[model samples]
Target: MNSIIHILQTQGNDILNSIGQHITISLVSLLIAAVIAIPLAIVLMKHKKIAEVILQITSVLQTIPSLALLGILIPIVGIGTVPSVIALVLYAVMPIFQNTYSGLTTIDSNLEEAAEAFGLSRSKKLVKIEIPLAMPMIISGLRIAMVMIIGTATLAALIGAGGLGTYILLGIETNNNALLIIGAVFSAILALIFSALIKGISKLSLKKIGIIFMAVIVLMGGYFGYKTVEKPQVSITIAGKMGSEPEILINMYKDLIENDHPNMKVSIKPNFGGTSFLYKALKSNSIDIYPEFTGTVLESLVKTNKDASHDPKATYNLAKKLLKEQENLDYLKPMKYENGYALVVKKSFAKKYNLKTVSDLIKVENKIHAGFDPDFYQLKDGYPGISKAYNLEFASTKTMESSIRYKAIANNKVNLVDGYTTDPQIEEYDLVALKDNKEFFPPYQGAPLVSEKLITEYPELKATLNKLAGKISVEDMQKMNYQVAVKHEKASKVAHDYLVSHNLLREK
Candidate 1:
């Protein structure tokens, strides 16, 4: 319970900040949408057929998946808030456009005739009569659009647009339920408040726009003041895969430095999804530092065929040598243990069958159930390759999400599952990770990958992480994972305790 409270306290600021970002993105997008949609609606009313065509086009855009749309936009607009805003604005247009059209078209023809009889020109009729009467419906549409945008704006985080969605996505990826709940609750509140305010404004006299304008000004001032007061010097960006252990390690590094090295400001930028994403970010200089496995860099990137050895130290040295000579990058000293994939089964199930290794599993293969991720299953070096190498065939096979596979094994749904060697749950569940007698799986020794520029700028940074070398074994990592994954402990707390226990934090 204390952990829960601490998570809230630590992440409360992030939640609030994300809410502010979410509101800003939604409001800016809505404002742009309103400007474009309202004018289009007014013009289209005169040409009903044209209006129908344009609305149809916009409705189609709304149907496009948000993530796919963002991916399509990335090449043209690049990353950050611009593409996110554009996406949100595009999404918001249908509601605003529909509302404006409905409100304007529904106005009684008698109202137009009354204006004509009063000698009011088209402009005067629209500004004074038509708009005022249609104001309620138009505002109602804006209210709905605002709510929709608020919910959808969460997707903006995927493209590096900072918002409440960042917290929610991270929460889901890391299994941090508190962050998810907080992000959802606050975003909902913001949407409700905005909707209510729009409704209230619609009922107010014209004079109320003045009060609204003043309120916006006051809020902006306070926000700016807070930002200016808390601004830090020497901010550095640490990029890594979202929800990966590297991200957690980076966060630990940040906390250690912030408490010990006060001059440095560290911010985590989780470039989630795939390994290719991190490589691109690193090559493009969008990210300064990240944790990478030596074997991955050596085999995947460098493409060096040095006899396919399983020795991690040799792999690290070879990778470091090639990186320095070729890519002008630095591969730091490797950490204690290699985090590799292990074919595991429940202890009881393994003992019952007397299965001690991959070779042993081949004897009873037809009796076992196997589960793996689709990607892992498809990879040539994955299950198919492993199966051929070991000559094992299972009773049934299924592809599943990486997160779900562990649960499936624990629940006895699958007799064998792909397990990360360093996962703490391996210990908690008393699973038996079979030895690979053939060594089909390659080495995956953990190490920091940094640009030559970073090393030249801050020589101390490399040594900082190297100190954590040999500190975390497979068991240590598993214990940490258990704290967050099963015990429901806050990641920050787990990281903090680990750092303190190791004396990684400088003595104050």
Candidate 2:
């Protein structure tokens, strides 16, 4: 309870910002869904067979997992508010469409016959009689949709849409229960308020409804007008992976760059699913720059086998040249840390099996269970690379979220797990990093990949960001990660502290 209150106190402004963003997304989605669904529903009333097929299709879309839908849309629409609104609009369609169809179809046949007897035209009868009578049911459907949209809008934060869900996802990522509760509770309140507002609107006279809608339009116009007036000179979006180190670096970069150029407004789009998602988002221009590793891009993305070995400079040069010629992306300066993937095992399990390296895992083949993120299983530099190099196989493999793998190993649910060398969880869970005797993995030096177009526009940004080159060592990054992933500190605070300590930022 105290923690919740503290979060509300410290983050009051952020909470309000999220509320406004949530209202905007939900309202816009509901409006779009209504525009399409109502007309489509009317058309369907004329074609029963087609209506059935369309209804089934909408039902299937609703059944597709929300996260899965976001994933599909991210590749096509990239990320941020556009994809989120599109997904929410699809979700909002079913209820409104069904209700409109039901209401129009259930109107009394006798009334229609009476109107026909009175010489009323088809369009006039629909406009004057059918729609007015069905308004109550349609309004009720809108109420239901409003509530569902409000709830689902919270998930938009996962793709960096910036709503109440931002707090929730941040809380989960940082292990802050108070922040999570604040987001969940506020979203519920918004839903309740909107539901009540819809109910009230349904009870209002036609004139009053018109007045309220006009007021909403005015408010929307004013909001947009304010945004246009205050638009920044330069708006830059920097994105990164889901882990602590990437999170910190992105925040640090945002702070330093924005501070250096007061006219520039820097924003972050975190949790871009993974490497593949980030890469696609960059190519599609959904994001400008993101933190990536040279070896990951070289071996996994570029599919290079020229044997750069453990040399960071060689790996970075090759990555830079290939990305420039192939993808039109520039690889920035490399950091001091090498955070490649490591096959980890509980110390006790390693002791029992006499396992010291990837080679030893092969000796115990078919005896141990392996747990890994689905991405790790699919990527070439993941299980495939390790398995082929060491000729190792596990008894059973389970794919799950990367965040939970640490706990799964700690609790003895899985014997071997794929982990990053810089992850604090290995130390927290008392796990051992198995040696890669074959050196199948190459150097993974962290760096930013920027769009060439962005550099052409803001050439100064390259130097501002590169000031961080070779600044953060493995120990510094590991500590920062431990502070966030272990101590539950805010990523921004950790990043800020690091920048200040390094004298990278002018202290305010």
Candidate 3:
């Protein structure tokens, strides 16, 4: 508990920023849903058949999985707040409209007759009598929708939309309970705050609620308008895949580049999404650069035969060539360390099984219960190729996230799991990496991959980037990862300390 408090105190700035983003996303999503669903509900109130059809359509939208919806939106609209807001709006519309429709339909006929008898116009009657009568139900619907929006907005982090979910996901990845607790607690608090606010709004007159909403809108607009006129700077966006290593590497990239070029502003979108997400973001100019492994580049970004050579030099050269020829991406000079995949197990288990190599796994294949990440379960250079190369198949397999697999193995829930050579948890959990004698997986030397547009615009960035060439060995990476993941240190601090100590960056 003391450790968690310490972490919270140290990460106060980051948590506050995440809270601001979380509030903005939640409120914006609910506001948009209100604009669409409330008016639609009003129109549908007089038409029973149309109301049923529209409600059914919205229900279908609600049923679409959040991830599936995000997946569909990414290629079309790209990542970040736009897609996140759109998906949340879709989920919110159903609840908002359904509750609103119920409220409008339940308004007493006597009240409408009284307003009609008072010579009130249709719009006037709606404002005077019908609205007052229906206000409770309408506010009820908004409260439900607002609470839903706040909770669901956490998913936005996966698409580079900043929120508390960033911590939540990172916590899961690093097996850090403090981070997980902070994210979950803050998210719940946001939902509760909105719910309380809506309850208070329900008690106030309609005019007061309208005033409050307009005030919020005006403040947000003014803030953005003011920001729009600020002094301009050359901004470059750098993104990375999930995990501490990528976050640390991007932090180094940011520090090195910004320290050298004071006029430049570096925006980091760490843990933006998966490999495909980052690649697409780069292609779309959403991100300028991200650290990618040579193995992933060869396997995912480009096509190759099943038996592509796993040699470090051969793979790096081929990846560099193919990326340039195919995607116009420039791969920086490779770092010294290789963060390649291996079949990992407890030291005791490996000793018991005499599992010294991937070939050795074949002998006890039926005894192995392995957990792997989604990509490893399906990718050619992963399970499929490993199975073919060694003629091995596990007795049972569970597909899970990269981070969860480590804890799963450590807890003795699964006997075998996939691991990157530089994962801090491998050392923390006392696990051993089984030798890949068959060379089924490619060498994953890290390098910064930049879009052509970025380099063309800022050609000097190449020099700053290449400064990391042949730097950061496996042991060095593991130590940095441990500091950030286990010690709960900020990635930026860890990265900065490493850079200064190694003379990679002068203290400025």
Clashes of 2: 0
Worst 10 residues of 3 by lDDT: 225-234
TM-score of each predicted structure versus truth: 0.81, 0.81, 0.90
Off by over 4 Å in 1: 1-21, 35-64, 68-83, 105-110, 121-123, 159-167, 170-193, 206-214, 221-230, 255-261, 270-286, 295-329
Query: What are the RMSD figures for all models against the true structure?
Result: 4.2, 4.3, 3.0
Q: Which candidate leads in lDDT?
A: 3
lDDT (Cα) of model 1: 0.77
Q: Which has the greatest TM-score?
A: 3
Per-residue alpha-carbon lDDT of candidate 1 for residues 1-508, written as tens digits (9 for 90 to 100): 5645766775677657777788888877877788789889998877889989989999999999987787667656655567888998998899899989988998999888989999999988887888788888789889988999999988877766779887677667654566677678778998999999888888876457547746766775587578678876335666666554665677776776577557887776653434554565566555667788876787677756575467767777888898888788888888787778789899998889898888998788788899898877998778988899988888999999776777788888998998778776687678978888888887788877887777788888776767777778877777787776556555667777888888887433
Candidate 2: Cα lDDT at 7: 62
After superposing candidate 2, which stretches have Cα over 4 Å from the reference?
A: 1-13, 39-79, 115-128, 167-189, 259-263, 299-310, 345-371, 374-401, 412-416, 427-438
TM-score of 2: 0.81
lDDT of each: 0.77, 0.83, 0.87
Candidate 3 residue lDDT tens string, 1-508: 8868988888899899999989988887888899899889888889999999999999999899998898788778877888999999999999889988898888888877888898999888877777778888888889888888888888888889989989888888777788889999999988888899898888988788789878878887787678678846438988888788999999999999998898899988877767887888788877889999888887779977744676899989999999998888889899999999889999999899888998998788899999999989988778887888888878999999776898899888899998888989978888888888877777999999998999999999999999999999988998898888877789999999999999988887
Give me the displacement of residue 121 in model 2, in angstroms: 7.2
